[model samples]
Target: MIAPTLHTERLTLRPLALSDFEPLAEFYASDRSQYVGGPKAADQAWRTLACEIGHWTLRGYGRFGVDETSTGKFVGMVGPWFPDAWPEPELGWDLMNGFEGRGFATEAGLATREYAYKTLGWKTAISLVADGNTGSAKVAERMGATWESKLNHHIFGDVNIYRHLNSEAV
Candidate 1:
């Protein structure tokens, strides 16, 4: 099924398109990159978005382009991803610098988690965060996920695992 657009008080989350690369490129080039594995060059960003698009076709769901509802500006992305050789589904997100600390990630994440469990019937979901990425870890915890274990992510490199089980309360 095609993933539908989701909205929150201040943001709109929808599937991304190749045309979004321009605005999203700024986030890829910002200092926030350290938390999200650092800035990717424009070319690499293009490659990443292409792969993300492919994930949508193969996995039935993929990242959504986050935009501010008030201004209709692209802010970031959030959704499901499967890392190389990983055996489970993963929840992931990245917000632009200007949009940080506003609870956008937490809000969007909660909605996605609900869709994953209640709508999609997923029993569990996982997130891989960089060891030093306290922001993301906090968001995961707010979504009712607990620390699982530290694992070397072949794609993102070193990371910590956080998981949410559908059987539990959020």
Candidate 2:
């Protein structure tokens, strides 16, 4: 089955594609990727993209590659993610290099959260932010999510969990 595409005023949240590899690898290899388990080797980045694509195949929903509507430039990936080992379903976003300071993440994050809540019928959603990643925290805040709690994940470490408001708050 084909995944659905989401549209925000300035972005198009579409399924990941092969063309995203180079950018994804560049992002993963840079210091900017630290918060998202990056600074990885090229092969590792390939595996990461493969896993992201596989997530949709297995779970029926996963992150979408974010693109700028006007330029059609790939900016990042954002959407609902729920690996079996995760504590709960999560709304996550990773902006590519040089895409920070823009409202792209905020715009895409809101759309993904709404998709999870209204379309996927989720009652609640949370975004996990690496402790020092102030940028991600700001994106969460911009989308009306509140700081929920802190967790020391086996993988991510020193994480801050931000919970999105329920439907009534939307």
* TM-score for each model: 0.90, 0.97
Candidate 2: residue pairs that collide? none
TM value for model 1: 0.90
Cα lDDT of model 2 by residue, 52-147, tens digit: 889998888999999999998999999999987688999999999989898999999989988988888899989999999999999999999999
Q: Where is the poorest 10-residue window by lDDT in model 1? A: 161-170
CA RMSD, predictions in order: 1.7, 0.9
Q: Return the top candidate by TM-score.
A: 2
RMSD (Cα, Å) of model 1:
1.7
Clashing pairs in 1: 33-38
Candidate with best lDDT: 2
Q: What digit string (tens of lDDT, one per residue) describes model 1 on residues 20-73?
A: 788667778777877675688878777777877778778888778888899888
